[model samples]
Target: MNIYSWNVNGIRAIQKKGFVEWVLKEDPDILCVQETKAQIEQLEEKLTQIDGYKSYFFSAEKKGYSGVAVYTKIEPLNIRNMDIKEFDFEGRYMELEYKDFNLINCYFPNSQSEGKRLDYKLRFNTAIMKRCNELVDLGKNIILCGDLNVAHREIDLTNPKKNEKNPGYLPEERDWMTKFLECGYIDTFRYLQPEETKYSWWSYRFKSREKNIGWRIDYHIVNESFVNNIEDAVILNDVMGSDHCPVVLRVSVE
Candidate 1:
């Protein structure tokens, strides 16, 4: 099964950039998108009615702000939000329970300049980790993927030294990621290609994409028990629509 995750930045905005066409061509078994920035009613039929894929959208209470979606050729057995009111209102997290595993698509809130929202972001991180552990304790495999809004290590970004005090690369954010991975979850891309420097998200300023000045913030993280089934994890920097490209996880379901 080929599962792809992307931070589309904005669903309507990307539609003008051939987002639908790209989806048809790439044809992943499952596509989890973050930062949809649109409600179901606000979208046109074309986006909601893509061929051969059933789409599920959970939009934020706020208009055109934070939202997430999943387009799957294989319909999930169950779909649910994390149900934590503070986090739920942002439309950040969802669970697509398949026969054997739960697929979570999440958009971590950006800890704005000088870590203004660092406390809130850290709480969200802890909540997610707790949810993952609870499922794992029940023998559930998890495929957690999306824009984590973090670059776990120095190698995950282009200029780690320059970005050390920045929002996404703050020491607190990196420490949480380290702690998350230590709690029975695996960062698939790093686990698969330890030394590769490919990135999924780039800054729109300073010709960042052109200069390859980017950070690998988007990810496909799975539980350690699911590692054996993870065939490959990749940062699809070649594909583009938003500031972030797609991260792919290929696995064997059978």
Candidate 2:
């Protein structure tokens, strides 16, 4: 199955940029979306009603803020808005449970440029890791995808030396990622292409995208048990709409 994830920035804004048309063209078996920034009720019918997919959305209580959605060609056996009340308020987490495994779409909290939200972002990383571990303990294979909001290594960002103190590249955040991965989740892209230096999110300033000075914050992470099932992991750098691009994971579950 081909599963893709993108942080669309704003669902409404991207819809105007032909997001629906793009979806139809790519036609992933499942498309997990993050940063939707709109409630289902606020969306126009055309935005919600793509022809061949079942769409599910979770919106933040705050209007035009953080949110997520999933458009799947295969209907899931069950879909859940995560039960973590603290983090769920922002609509940052959702999961689709299928016959073989669970696919989690998450939009991790960004540690603001000023570092004011750094603590919160770290807590979120810890919490989400715990949640994933719980599922793994139950023997459920997982595919976790979204903008994780951190650059775990020097290779993940364009200029690691300059970004060392940056919120997304802070030592603490990177360490947290190390701990998380040690818990048996594989960074699919790195697993497939360890020396690759591509990125997923680019700064909207200084012609960052054009120069390709970006960070690999978005990911398609899979539980170690399913690592052998992944056929390919890729960054769709050519696509545009959000500051982030889509990361695709092709896996064999059948």
Candidate 3:
């Protein structure tokens, strides 16, 4: 199966940039989007009628804020807006259960400028991790993908020294990722292309994207039990709808 994740920045904006056309061309079995930044009512009517997929959207109560949506060729057996306490307000997670596994589309909190929201982000991460572990315990193979908003390692960004104290690069945020990995999740892209210095997110500041100075903050992480079934994981750095490019993963399943 071909599963893809992209932080569209804003669904409306990307629609104007030919997102629909791109979706048809890629033809993924499932596509998960984050940071939609629009309510369902505000979305164009055409968006609800994509040709071959069943689309599910979850928007924040607050207008024009964080949101996530998932479109799949195979309709989920069940779809749920995760009820994790303290983390539901932002509309950051959507969980879908297929016949064999669970797919989670996440838009993790960005700590924001001046480290102002770090505490909230940390707490949010902890809650989600707990929820994910519960699903793992249920014997469901999980595919958790999103813009996690952390650079993860020195190789994940262009200039590690300069970004050492930055919000997403901070030790606390990076360590949270370490904890996730320790809990039996595999960072699929890194597992497939360990030495490549590729990236998925670029700053709009100072022509960062044109210069290829970016960070690999987005990911496709799966439970370790499914690691051998992963066929390929990649960053579509050449895509141009948003500052963040799409990450794709292919898995084999009988």
Candidate 4:
């Protein structure tokens, strides 16, 4: 099965730029998107009725800010909104439970300019990690994907040395990822291609994408039990609609 994840920045904006056509062409078994930035009522029927897929959307209580969505060829056995008051109100997390596994599509909180939101982002990281562990203890395999809003290693972003103080690459944020991996979550792309220097998200300023100066903040992280099932994990750098491109993970699931 093929699953894809992307942070579209703004769903309506991307839709007008041929996102719907691109989705039909790629035809992933499941597609998860972050930063939808719009309520369900604001979406046109074309996006809501994308041929063969059944789409689910979660919009933030504060309209047009932060939201997430999942489009799947197979209807989920169950769908869950994480409902943690501090996190859920922003519409950042959603879960689709199949018979054998659970898929989580998340848009982690970003530490905004001047580190104003750093504390909130850190709290979010801690809470989600706790939730992941709980799911694992329940004997559920998890495939977690979306824009984590972090660049976990020196190799993850261009000029990491120069961006050390930046929100995405800060020492504390990177350590959380290290701890998460140590606790049995595998970073799919890094596990599949350890030495590749590819990125998913680029800055709109400074002609970053043109120069390939970008950060691999988006990811498909799976539980250790699902590692062997992963056929390949890739960064689709050429596929562009937002500052962030799409990340695809292929697996041998039934």
lDDT of 4 at 23: 94
Error of 1 at 62 (Å): 1.1
Per-model CA lDDT versus the true structure? 0.94, 0.92, 0.92, 0.94
- lDDT tens digits, residues 208-239, model 1? 99999999999999999889999999788888
List runs of model 2 lying over 4 Å from the truth.
none
TM-score of each predicted structure versus truth:
0.99, 0.98, 0.98, 0.98
lDDT of 3 by residue, 1-254 (tens): 99999999999999999999999999999999999999898988788668999899999888899899998999999988778656667899999998767999999998987779999999888977887899999998899999999999999999999998898999899999999999999999899999899999999999999999999999999999989889999899999999999999999887
Worst 10 residues of 3 by lDDT: 81-90
Per-residue lDDT over 153-206 for candidate 2, one digit per residue giving the tens place of the 0 to 100 score: 889999999998787888888888998999888999999999999999999999
- Candidate 3 shows a clash count of 0
Tell me how many clashing residue pairs each candidate has.
Answer: 0, 0, 0, 0
Better of 2 and 4 by lDDT: 4
Error of 3 at 67 (Å): 0.3
